[model samples]
Target: MRGLWRAHRWTVASGALLGLSGALLAVWGNPVNTGICISCFLENAAGALGLHGNPRMQYIRPELLGFFLGSAAAAVLAREFRARARGPGLHLLGLGFLMAVGSAVFIGCPVKAMLRLAGGDLTAVAGAVGLVAGVRLGIALLGRGELGLGGPERPAPVLVPAGVVVAVAVLAGLAFVPGALIESRTGGGAQHAPAAVSLVAGLVLGAACQRTRFCITGAVRDAFLLRAAAPAAAVVAVVAAAVLVNAFTGSFSVGYYDQPGAHLQWAWSALGMGLVGLVAVIAGGCPFRQIIRAGEGDLDAATVCVGMVLGAALVQSWGLGGTTAGVPPAGRVAVLLGLAGVLGLALTRKERIA
Candidate 1:
């Protein structure tokens, strides 16, 4: 197994691990079809930090903390740990905000979209389609050599931010330290596997992804632009494994109606994910990848993380997120506005020489 990983079979191995982890998370306790949603987990993390007053979503999910620590450990061991600056700061912040907004509008990011589909929510098909379309739009701009961030830092200083993240994780874990923090009493917030299990799963995933440089955005982008199949194949493997596991464990439910944490508005799902796809392309990674990047000491990725938390708060406070009935009018408007913002950025940003 170690030899396979060393030889660059990281994709298949990590994909299988992700699939198994999702299935186990579902069996262990997470909202149905939402074993490990990057957006949802971030919102939950925000709520845990008292960033918002959403009781139902407030809890310190160890999975998120594990992603950071696990990746950091792997990077350090591999001698790949380095801190880098991301430029066009204000623009990157805006793009991150829009990315979160879009994800909230749909109640899922790319990972959740795929997981939802694996669990038999046919509505996710719309989201998947939108994701593809959005990626294609970004590709069009890339073809013109627009929307690039500047070069990497020469002397990378990674430890400081990594230490900060570790501190935050420790504080987050204090939720279990006997009344040190508020916790969700019911619903999705109430559901979770043991902290140890979730954290370990996250750590394994983080390490594998870091080693392989895995990014869902990169997967789609490479598949379309470079005709690369490895990343895309990894995605397929995950989906297949998730589907199989869910079916075997009776976690899979066919059809779309009354799916937990999901609305049936087809157009909103498509449009919301489309917005996510655009911003993810602009930001250079999906939500989870951004988190991993932050763990690796990219300050800009940290900026995006903050934006995502703010976006979650904004949606919840303004009632712009989807509910069981359907997508809210406010969410619909947000998606449209987000797309417009992305378009403006794409046109105005100077082309970067990579």
Candidate 2:
């Protein structure tokens, strides 16, 4: 136990921070079990940008900008901010798009799935299973040399970081300007903690995540392929912290029926999250990780982030998002197609099997 603690102390700390912040975000005013949803925030931000016309989902989430800016700040301060691009840009973007689709179908990302579970939503169980399966599959392919992403990573122009930083600044500025962004007055998007509070939460979590490299899918990957002690410890820390906070705040509930922001389609949820796991492995991080990497001037990750926003917009505009009632037919088909498409893409990048 002492050895495990030393191995994952930073990861555990960061994970606990995320868990506590996630539950408290809702307590402070954000939607239930949605303290930190990358896909949901993308949907809201997309609507705010008029990429989609979902009024109930339109709002500029300061947490998104906070994540980006905070990560950039951390990377710059640590001298880890390198402008680099690798692999096929369009393909990497597709991974991000697929991640958005999967999260939309599951009604949340892996992080939110865990938050839901911490709140005692059993429906998230299927999602957790699917996520692990996907991560395991990704690892299998990677180990077998079937994933052809192995190549020399090329360095991008140093000016790339400047442009990315400027973009983050503009978005952060917009979050503060009155009427600069679309604010939803009716639905989940309308229900949010104070902008300043949410942004601070995102900043602290984002910076911590950057330093610790704490990622949901990455933890799953580590647990499956590498050392289990650290990843397991971090995962437990997140769920335990969230559970404790929820129970304290009267938000914890037993059973899964009628849970907030969740659906009963367990099979589909698994499949959707499975897609997320697969892409995170292929893309080098989950949606949240992609945003952090983008902040650090990784063009590959930046492309994925752009794809995520586009996917978020397309899902709503095309009515491909799941809902409390159930997953839409369109969303279902999209998830199936996304799985097939991403798998095909990964195959194309494969080398020889060992």
Candidate 3:
């Protein structure tokens, strides 16, 4: 299949897979306008674990575990399961933290932004622009070749099974342990597709994504920095397919106002996503890619994932995230701070001009 993908238009295949997976997820029961939001799902999972007391958003989503395990399976099957854990863990941790915070403020990741656009949310346009602008800035800095983190030394394949084991244990607990995980009494947390459907969709999407190395941030970055269209083609496919599905399925509603779990604050949306994009590019992948990398045993990616979960908890607990009313002042301030931190990191590196 991997070889076949290489022979064919792999980008289209990947994008189609993502688009279909997202549409199917929505049909299967996720909240309207939200199919497979990595950040949002993580936020919900954090709430489920009692990491946050938001009763409106609590559920031990199985999709997170499914994605990790599925990616691990793909990596192992393809012999791409190399474990590399080098570089500054604190840097990755902090970047991941900022990535999560930014996404929380925006109420979505790059994927969600795209999905929102596909669902006819014009508010996501600003966010998408911010993402592109952020990537462009990262590309400019990357040209100087100073952004490389130190490389990993040893391969820790054991982390693969360890991660899978943890995922399985969590899934089992969510399934069998009554009240072990919190449930949302109302709001977005109360909305969900069945666990089985969501998990299966996640597993399928994870395996496909891992095989293709599909990443929303990477797609945007490569499109701009490397003049690569294949990845971008895949991303476009996701949007096109999602739009078609939503339109036919009656999920498409064009407008920013009254969008599910979203606000009409265009500037905040853009700035928030810009922060997410900037940090994601610096960190080398989007939120979902980080999860897949963790499954493949990249300790840095794992660290980032943990940081994202922590960020999610912090945002909800501290009221740093926005609600349907509008963007919170705290959230906007956090975006500015996150941008400052990312800029400092980008410029402080000692890479010589090419």
Candidate 4:
């Protein structure tokens, strides 16, 4: 496995495969253009658990479970399962929550934003611009000695895997059970890809990403700031593969204002992802990275995941998220708050890595 990852072609090919497979899965299923959105899936899971009563967006996504489990397996096998934390736990939790809210406002994470664009959602282009702008801003902050939140202290050996096991068990139970809290009968909320397929996709993507260190934000950031082309090349590979698959499957539609499950407002889309880019950089990785880190026993990443789940619930409960029309007022406010939070962190921190 290590030998394969050391080969650049293998790593890029695996990433492209993960992206293509995930996109194909979404098209085959009824998740619209979204193949495997970390934030959206987490939000759906939160709604499925009755965290919020958003009927159209409730379901336990199997992909998420596969992600953690796959990453865990890789970590264990690779001897990379180091349990460690660095900074304040609660603050990271707050940042994660804000990041989730911002992502919800845009209706996608960095990965989904790219997928959305590849599927011909013009609004995703705005979000992509915002994401790059945010990352650029973050880089500037780093130049100014702006430090962000660190990790938490490592815990006992049993705690990390035990936590992951508990999370997996809960997700598995939700996948099988169908009660009022589970929302299995609803057409929209209960809709899901076949559990087996979702799990397999997640497992493959997670393991490959763990080996190759694939990150959407890092891809763009490296290209724009560091003058590196490798990360960006991987992103282009995924985008090309996904676009081809989506076109072949009749899933490619062009337009910004009326994409399925996406809003048309260009401003908010950009700002929402701008917030995500800033916060993610401050947090030391994108949402995907955070998930993998959580699997590797980073409690801070776990806290961020919790924040995403809670933020999903809050967005639904407060009507702060969007459907197809546009972002709610509260959702806009959430994005602003995210921007403020990240800026505050950037300004206040003492150490500068850039």
Candidate 1 Cα outliers beyond 4 Å, as residue runs: 1-8, 146-156, 350-354
lDDT of candidate 1 over 12-110, digit per residue (tens):
677667777887797898778777888888778777778787789877788877887787888889987777775666766777778877888788888
Instruction: Give the clash count for each candidate.
Output: 0, 2, 0, 5
Off by over 4 Å in 2: 1-5, 144-150, 346-350
Give the whole-model CA lDDT for all candidates, comma-separated: 0.78, 0.87, 0.79, 0.76
Q: Could you estimate the TM-score for every candidate? A: 0.92, 0.96, 0.93, 0.91
Candidate 4 lDDT over 150-207, as tens digits, reads 4336564757655775768577656766563455456555556787888888887778
Q: How far is 67's C-alpha from truth in model 2 (Å)?
A: 0.9
On the 0 to 100 scale, the lDDT of residue 155 in model 1 is 42
Quick one: best TM-score, which candidate? Answer: 2
Per-residue alpha-carbon lDDT of candidate 2 for residues 1-354, written as tens digits (9 for 90 to 100)? 467668778988988998999999989988999998899999999999999998999988888888888888899999999998877877777778999999999999888988999999999999999998998888876755534244677899979877878877898788889898888888998999998998888888878888888888988888776655667677778889999999999999978788999999999999999999988998888888888888888888898999999999999999998899999999999999988886775576546454
Residue 239, candidate 1: alpha-carbon lDDT: 82
Expressed as tens digits, the lDDT of each residue in 131-197 for candidate 3 is 8888778777776554535654666667564765577656745654667778887888777888787
In candidate 3, residue 217 scores what lDDT? 81
Best by lDDT: 2
Give the Cα-based TM-score of candidate 2 against the true structure: 0.96
- Listed per candidate, the RMSD to the true structure in angstroms reads 2.9, 1.6, 2.7, 3.0
